[model samples]
Target: MATMEYNVFVGSETGLLKAANCAEEKWNNLNTLEDVKKDNEICCMCWGSSQQEKVYFAQRNQLIKVYNILSGEICEEIELNAGEGKFKNIAVFDQQILTALDSGIVNLWNNKGESELEIKTGDKLSCMRQNFFKRNLVATGGKENPLKLWDINKPTEPIFTSKNVPHDWLNLRVPIHVMSIGFIPKSEKIVTGTGYHQVRVYDPSTYQRRPVLNVTFDEYPITALTVCPNGNQVIVGNTQGNMTKIDLRKGNVACRYKGFAGGIKDLQCHPTLPYVASCSLDRFLRIHHMDLKHIMHKFYMKSRLNCLLLSKKWPTIDDEGGSPTDVSKEKIDDMSDALWDKLPVLGSKEQLPSGKMQKTKKRKLATKELPKQKMKKSVC
Candidate 1:
């Protein structure tokens, strides 16, 4: 098969990796159905190199599969034995592969899949993220695990460790459950989302151990989050399927996107564009414009999605070979019309000969009826 370029790559719970071209509305399953197994389900994914020509994904089976974008084939597979639980996240730096497991074991593997260095971050590691600007720096956190920043070169103790917030006004201890982490660009600040519905920003440069900025979203636990390209805001998704963009400066909600039916699993902001892509347990991959606050493209994969990766080479709307705004608006209108047609219309109420109300079919009108007391008063 010829090499194919895709804008989006999605990993699913069924152990299937799919590539999509948003402009073309095309999808291709990179893995065969025969290889699909419970243990092969992908849990985390990261670009293998800055070139974006390859991808590294970790499975529940403790295997890291590297897929080549140029040839569209599995280039290599690295098995990980240093971790105990499922992989929470994976990162690539230099030529080494970094894998973090729920047991809090972080291992850096060489080309031969030999462990070069290992660091025990903490227990219940929910997330591990590398600083894109400083590839050698990484952050890790999880349930009851405060955020810690490590320098992979010197894999001894963390350079900076975050302290839990002080007790609440009622004198009750606060909980710590860092479910996701993101490093803001052009700065050393790190943002984290917790299971306690909190979004916090930590400044490593400051002597203060606690968060410099802390804000809460909805009532449910935050499951996924990503810093936007602007670095002034971060987008977060909760367990209840709510995705909101929050201004980091003031710690206020900027906007919220709709159309999610299940909890978000992963979120990725485009490196250069005003777009953010998200995958959810609802089995849908959606791309939304940050400013528009509306979905630009939505694709339904047969299996539940776990992680999403957006290529830096993703095509712009104009690259789709048409007027960008017109084409997108037309597509959106067609989809909306189709969905509206499928919905059943409510019938209007009408009086029958016996003074009872009857409904007329095929009409789009209010079907609500007056209560008995109101009806009697109106009749009298």
Candidate 2:
């Protein structure tokens, strides 16, 4: 394979856009979003075009920036009319840009086509995710908001909306505060995190409007949620700097991980590798191995990171020095082999079938016979 390739892009709280290509060798492609004052605090970014060279990003200043990844040039800029409230989510579908505002409004714009679609989500929004299997479908929710899915082609009504959980022991109606949302790949099922620090999975196909499975974490609002590529588990991070990998099938935490000194702003897992990258108020980008729970790469980007996007491609065995910075299976095997090579060889021992000890033969000392005469010689 001629160095498999995938693109990675991240936008930070300080309004910087970083881009790079992951390949067989260490990635040297990086960009700092410092020069453009308007690009500060990138809220969302994605491949706006079919080509790998172009991308679109939403900013905190109500401006959307389009850039050419290969040339490091701003190709176009579209301004959002939505007043106040930061952008919480953005996605590209059918050559149109869809942005969800914290104030609960979603706008779909086609700058080149000069067509726009807007919808009022009622309550303010915090996050939005598109169902890859259903390109025309999307899920959106936020603080005190219920998770809702809409068919973008219509934009007037939601196809599904989550029903609140039943009353507690006191029979008080439970309030909902959706903080983040994720859609299961290839299924109508969706998962959401809430301000109450709960993770719930909902299947719209079922008659029950309530979550099929609901689990709680630490008492902090969930800030980030990412479904594993396998679509069997979801990685959740909350406002308290807590992270956990929840097994959907088991309906419980599969593993607990540590390392975020500050609350996690965002998390993204490698599509094909057992690695996850996260950036947060700690001002550092950390890549972790899901299985080993090892921090593979730690890069101080010198800013509070709010979001991350990882490449889907991973290095393979045949590539030359495949991804020196990435901790893939090939790299781990090589490291294990090298580690075993450095271990000390043990001293050889005789093989024994039974639990018996070998007795040493007693030899008569040649000087023993003279021992009895030692006193006589000394006296002479």
Candidate 3:
């Protein structure tokens, strides 16, 4: 088995420090917010690689700013239109910045403060997600009763759109409120968490609703959805302070745990490990391993953690010699054939819930009443 390493990097009242291995609780006062120059209420934090340094981005109500982790200095800052609306969502793409407005639009801007594009969306443009495999494509959905998919190159029109696409739980009778969206990494399917504690996966090729994965939460309004680095597990965090993990291939619950005292708002998986990080209204940033035990490793923040991003672990080529040329191609082919024979087929309807709402055999419509089309007066 490959040995996995875990590390906790936190910013606290003292300064940025790598917590003593497995002794996170002992290393209190790890750092302070003075490193970022903010009054607090930080909604998002992301680490990205620039040149040889790892840079971090932290967004508050009025500013989208960047910091060089190596130098511990704020490198760039741009004023965002987040006065009345909090900078609830922030995504860093190349040098371009994408932010979602509570006012129901997604704005893209360049590094030099030039507005790139704006996507007008539903009533509450609650969340926005980028494709893990393709950065240019983004999906946004919220109380609008519809999910919008837009390509960055063409912001005026969405390539795909769907309403009442089973984005919510079955018991919820309200219009689909797509609170969160997550991509399945390399796959075309993406899952969105909705208001009723339900998550739905759909094929991007066609906007039709497909497999409805009912998630059990301690409460309603699933706020975040994230796929583990392995791509085999899906996890969702809800308002009731529960983070449930499900096996995507098996369509079965893998594990469930109470992530925080208050509701969970956002979660991010380690870029290269099986670790998961989440933030909650309970004013805590917690990290856990995606396993049966679901060990709670560290609690880092004091205010509600609105968003998080782990540093990407780039893979390095082994200096040791690889497979020898003497290894026959026929032997490799034989091993591949054996593995294929044991692959599991994902073709079963999930077991119906017992106390929960009956599995609706027929798809639910947005509204029972269809609008009447007025009959034009006969010209004759």
Q: Model 1, 57-148: lDDT tens per residue?
A: 98999888999988889999987677469989899988899889899999998988899899999888999999999999999999989999
- Local accuracy of candidate 3 as per-residue lDDT tens digits, 55-80: 44434445666655455445767775
State how far residue 219 of model 2 sits from its true place (Å): 2.5
Clashing pairs in 2: 15-40, 15-41, 24-323, 144-177
Whole-model lDDT values for every prediction? 0.89, 0.76, 0.62
Instruction: Report how far residue 190 has shifted in candidate 3, in Å.
Output: 1.0
The estimated TM-scores of all candidates read 0.85, 0.79, 0.68
lDDT winner among the candidates?
Answer: 1
lDDT leaderboard ranking: 1, 2, 3
Query: Candidate 2 at residue 327, lDDT?
Result: 35
